[model samples]
Target chain A: MTTLMNRQYYLASRPAGAPDSSNVPARDVPVPEPADGEVVLKNLYISLDPAIRGWMGDDPNYIEPIALGDAVRSSVIGRVVKSDSPDFAEGDVAMTVGAWEAYTRVPGVMLNKLDEAAGIPLSTYLGVLGPTGLTAYFGLLDVGRPKAGDTVLVSAAAGAVGSVVGQIAKMQGCRVVGMAGTDDKCRWLEEDLGFDAVINYKQCGDYEAAIRVACPKGVDVYFDNVGGEIFDAALLCLNKFARVAVCGWISTYNVPDAPGPTNLWQLVAESVTVQGFTVIDYMDRFPEGIAQLAEWVVAGKLQFREEIVDGLDNILPTFLRLFDGSNQGKLVIRIPEE
Target chain B: MTTLMNRQYYLASRPAGAPDSSNVPARDVPVPEPADGEVVLKNLYISLDPAIRGWMGDDPNYIEPIALGDAVRSSVIGRVVKSDSPDFAEGDVAMTVGAWEAYTRVPGVMLNKLDEAAGIPLSTYLGVLGPTGLTAYFGLLDVGRPKAGDTVLVSAAAGAVGSVVGQIAKMQGCRVVGMAGTDDKCRWLEEDLGFDAVINYKQCGDYEAAIRVACPKGVDVYFDNVGGEIFDAALLCLNKFARVAVCGWISTYNVPDAPGPTNLWQLVAESVTVQGFTVIDYMDRFPEGIAQLAEWVVAGKLQFREEIVDGLDNILPTFLRLFDGSNQGKLVIRIPEE
Candidate 1:
């Protein structure tokens, strides 16, 4: 039998601004057989998230920065082609912390077995019923802690986590306002996702004024995904005793030496709590988050959009769509099974 | 009583940097007669806190900005010279939100009647056992939430609030590190207050390096009283899930358009919580905090310093000492009872 080959994009060097081919280079190598308790999988779905951009830089260690020469770290679903442990079998589908590659070799203990016959789309696990859903579930409810009638403002509102956050806030009886980069995304948020108000930040001349118009009651909870001038504006719009749940600063991840929010003193002005967290912070409650999210998706209470870009060759450009706000909803790279 | 002439410092104009005579002009105006529920106090001890500087500016409304033509807002302990309410009688000593004036006329309900016969210096109510102590008590315990063995680092560690915060952390069974401007203050924190380690921030080459040297375990709780480059450095030294209890940013209060802490991205990196609050946030629980603090003071477990400057004329200069870090501990203006 011919040897299986893996096409992978590995971190060649840390990028100063937006990444290029020089920083992340691609190559083909022989797929290694599973060793000890390891399982080798042919990747089918690769989640493209702003967090992946964060892992590429070494500036902030929210999670451990992806080491040089390693395949860029990501959440991936794959079909197990080889296994050295009883936990996984050949052809069994599983999800794990993998990489930007055609094949992934992971420890059996790290893999979460997925059921393909359950009728739930496999890609949903990478989006609404997985880490993306869990991030919104915990970050909003746990950090934001919105009460009924409280105004919840979400930045990067069209993105996977922010969308889920706004939906969850609405269910919590909050007046949900969203800020997205494009008019299309704004319409999607207001018309489709049930956001009380949506600000097309691209057209909004002054962020503070736009936020004020959108949130008359002022923002009690601000789920911040994009941190920069927008984050600075949100600081000014916060209500007394407001809470800023910082999920990630996606806007500043690619830029070198991004300026910190200038209006942090508003914290004292309003007695605010600005907390930073990641989905991994709730590792032990993964099962609970997945079950609750699945229930919502099945009962038709939750609505989400998944933009799937096919082929491993389109992975890099597909991922870049996240930074420019071009892609809709949860972005995923699909490599169809041969 | 000879028609009382109240000599008070009123805000003439908003100051650009430090308030000179023009910004805060003194005028002798006729004292207003007691209203139906009003009690007039012959001001004895005026509390000069860093928070007073924030009230002088028209920006960041933590409390209502001291309106133009209004005397600079402060906390003062005084003798009730006149009373129109049954709750207060003439010669009763009380503490209330007064001003930089010889006498204050306030509603009887706003006054916290002090027991001068309890053998405690009435000025101590303005420092160790009043808002200053309660600030440290709630800010360190409620916000910082140190879990015995946690490393607590305090900036402006010799000031009224910081000094008390370090002592409170010690009682909670934590390794306490302090950062102060002078060797004397550092020595006081180490030798007198039982701080495990101390850093003279002015002499220290880099704030981050000094903090690392002083706190080898990394800072679990950073009680920040001064914010600026020192705060940027402190962000770099925070451990995972660290809590930053921001009492006030005295450093930037005077500097116009002071750049914010540059390394705020560390919040996401460490899952940190940065909360800003005032003692007023705990107004409902003030009695509880004051009682607990008084217990610690009575047992000799808590130590504080108060620098009392004589005469109301020295109020502006004495208050400015806070910005320069010159005055040690709680700085107060004392006008001897006539």
Candidate 2:
């Protein structure tokens, strides 16, 4: 058998602000054989998340920063090419926290075997049916805790996590208002995703006014994905005892000197609850989340979209699209068939 | 019966910044007669709290703003001079949400009869055994949720709510760090309040460094009463899954253009929970809080202090002392004996 080479991206240096080619560069290395209790995965899809920008920063955060010369950390959907553990077999599709690479050698313990018979695309696992779905599930339902007739406002509403958040809030009998970057995205959120109202934030000059018009009764639960100005506007419109789930702050992820919400005192004035969470914290309950999310999808209550990039070569540019608000839904790269 | 005149302070105009004589002015009117189900309360001890500043503002808040020409809202301990309801009788001491006045016509339903034989000062009911104590109890225990090994940091540590918060956190077997304005206050917190560490924020120019030295293990629970810089500093020292009880923002109460915390994203990075609450929201649990606090006070496990200003004539100046950090503990104006 001929030796195969694996192309991967590594953290060359910590970026000052937004990452570019200079900070994260690609390198080629020979694919390694699966050792005992490990599996050799042929990566098919790599998730490009706004969270990647946070992991690239040198500051202390929810998880350890990616060390210099290390393969950039990411979540990937891959097929096992070789397995030396009882948990996984060759040709099995699995999901794991892997690297931005064409092939990865992962510990069998880290892998969650995918059900190819589930009839959903494997990429959905990385979007609505995987961690992204779990984030929207637990953050909105558990953290936000919306009641029927409650007004739920979501930012970055057309994106993967926000889209799922709006749908789940709707399923819970809430009046959902979403804010997205483009008119097209807002239309999709309203006309297609069943959002009660949508605000194209890029065109809406006064977000507070737009929010007031959309949510006349005031927002009872704010599912914030894009922080900063939008967050401040939402704070002004919060009803008494409102809940704000501090999901990803995608807008400020790249800006090192991002300003915080000035209206945070509203949290006190309105008796609001603002909680920040990561999906990893709920790892023990993953089975429950996955099962529930699957049921929602199967019942036609939850819908999702994927903006799939064609190749690993376009990873850096595709990742940048997350910050620019260019990519809709869950941004992922489909690797070249080997 | 001889006619009695009532002396009161009214909200003349909404202050552009900090309130002064022009905004909150004094007036004299005839003492109101008790209507059906009402009692005429001769205000004796008036409680001065930082929350009063929020009420003076024209903007919407937890409670309705003090409308112009309305008696400035306050919590008062008084003796019922006249009663038209069976719930109250002449000469009975009670606590009620009244006004900055010599006499208030209050609904008997709103008055809580105080036990004169409880062996605690009637004014203590305005402090440790009243709304102040209840605020600390519920805000710390219910919102902060400190574990035994947690590092609890409290701002305005020598003041009413903060002082009680520190003592109770200590009772819960947590290490407590306090931040106060003056060295004397810090000393009082460390020497008397059982705080493990204290930072005199006035002298500690670099609050973040001081917090690092005080709470080496990182803050697990932050009971923030004084917002602005001290609050921002505490945010930087938060441990994973930290809980922040946003009790008040005294520092910004006087400053109309207060800067918001820039490091708020740390809430997301650390998976923190920040909740804002008022004692009013937990009215249903007041009996539990009052009982527990009374037990602690009786068992000598809890201690409190009151800065009493003699005479109703000192009410305005006494209220001003709250924002200036001139009062070491709970500030109360003692009405001269009638």
Candidate 3:
């Protein structure tokens, strides 16, 4: 028996700077067949993250850049249509990269078979239980090295990575301060996530003053996802021997030129250490992170939130939400069944 | 019968910016008597380093500031006049932090007894076997860590510290390049000190081009003493995982407002590590450094140079040479007997 496939999204042209709807052209292509050691997956949910901006360019990074006119790269939860590999069979759910399309072929070694009958939602695998959660886990523990009673400051605190980072810091017995673009997100962090303090950066004209109030003792460990004025403000208020893990510079990726921080001299005065890292550096211990995140979710010690939009057509607009700070939590695209 | 005491110089007033002869008022002070565990020494030769600027300012540092109306602070080598302590007698030569004057009363604990009769000149103890040598030793070993055949670059190479640093890198089996302000200094470094290559930055309109010619394999370790445009150029040509040991920033110390580098993003791109350190941080390993340096000198593996200016009255002018690159090698002031 044959099955019909929906339209797939392929890369049309490489972007010079910020990517828009026109930069990524969508087209229909034949569904791929599962050869030996391969499985054909019908993508159900795709994860859109800020890291995609780096993949769009031909820069050197941990992951390979997707070539122009190739299918846009993403992580997706999908159901197997056919499996030529021994590890998977037809109708088995799998998690793999390149979930931006309706159907993708993944190798058996790379696919993680999931039990769809389980009570947990599918989008959770793309978020708190997947790459984002693992990033927050290793970045906070190995890089930042937060301790009990230490002050932890996280930028973009209400977003996917930041929200999880605050809760983990709180769980580790730290005084957490979350900086978000809106009052509602800040309020949610304080009220729902048990954060010690929250600052709506949009309302405050002086970010350093806001940080002074939010973090009275000064920041010990800073997980920097957004790198712009907030980064400079945080850098100014860092305590002696502070550790800054630069996971992503989402703030500068869109701009043609990157701006300089005027207060970089503060690093010398405080003996601060700043490091830029990608999640691939911690891939060896990814399972430990996923298991711990799962245990936290089941024990009610951690909460996961998602803003799911219907249809594959909405992926571009949903991805743009990351730059505008519109989404409260992890953003996902739920593809309709063909 | 009491003999006439030697004359000394006192701080007349703090300068707004660059120090001058008017800033130090020459005066005749009564030679101080040695108390218990103390030795009164007749100042023979004293090192006039750039660090004196830090002592003259009211800013906090590792050591105490020089107060107005008090004798200026410096590192000096002298002969003991009378010792109340068991460590030394009337004729023992010693090195202590007492430059700036004809006679200095130093605690015995702070004095390192020197043997002027040893085959080497007493002035060498103030250059290659003193704090300058220690700075170069630790800055290279602990910070730069140059590997065999690696390209090592030293700024202000003909100066006391840079000369030893480049020689040490050569001894470690690395390709050494020295950057000096004058053609004569560059010739001296290449001919006398065994540097693989030398660049006279004053003559070279394009330093990066000179660096490319001198260092065909690119710079792996950059020992930076002169900071400003020289530092900015080095940062651009640093290899991946390069180490920059910032021993001093002499270029910016005299300027009222120092301009920051525009190419700092290169640091992030190349994953370069820049560390600032002081000689005091390696007090425990001073003996090891001095021993190795002395052995190198005795074996003809290392050479020492001193630029001596006679009379304590010339201290201000001699000291000013460091800022203008007028003095070659270590600048020392030789005081006359009373």
lDDT of 2 by residue, B202-248 (tens): 88889999999999999999999988988888889999999999999
Model 2, span A94-203: residue lDDT tens: 99999999998989999989888978898999999887899999999988999999999999999999999999999899999999999889989999999999998999
- Residue B240's lDDT within candidate 3 is 71
Model 3 chain B: which ten-residue window has the lowest total lDDT? B262-271
Error of 2 at A115 (Å): 3.8
Each prediction's fraction of true contacts recovered = 0.76, 0.77, 0.02
What's the TM-score of chain A alone for every prediction? 0.98, 0.97, 0.96
Candidates arranged by DockQ, highest first: 1, 2, 3
lDDT, model 3, position A321: 87
Clashing pairs in 2: none
Clashes of each: 1, 0, 1
Interface RMSD of 3: 4.2
Query: DockQ of candidate 3?
Result: 0.20
- Interface DockQ per candidate: 0.78, 0.78, 0.20
Q: lDDT of all predictions, in order shown?
A: 0.92, 0.90, 0.83
Q: How accurate is candidate 3 locally (lDDT)?
A: 0.83
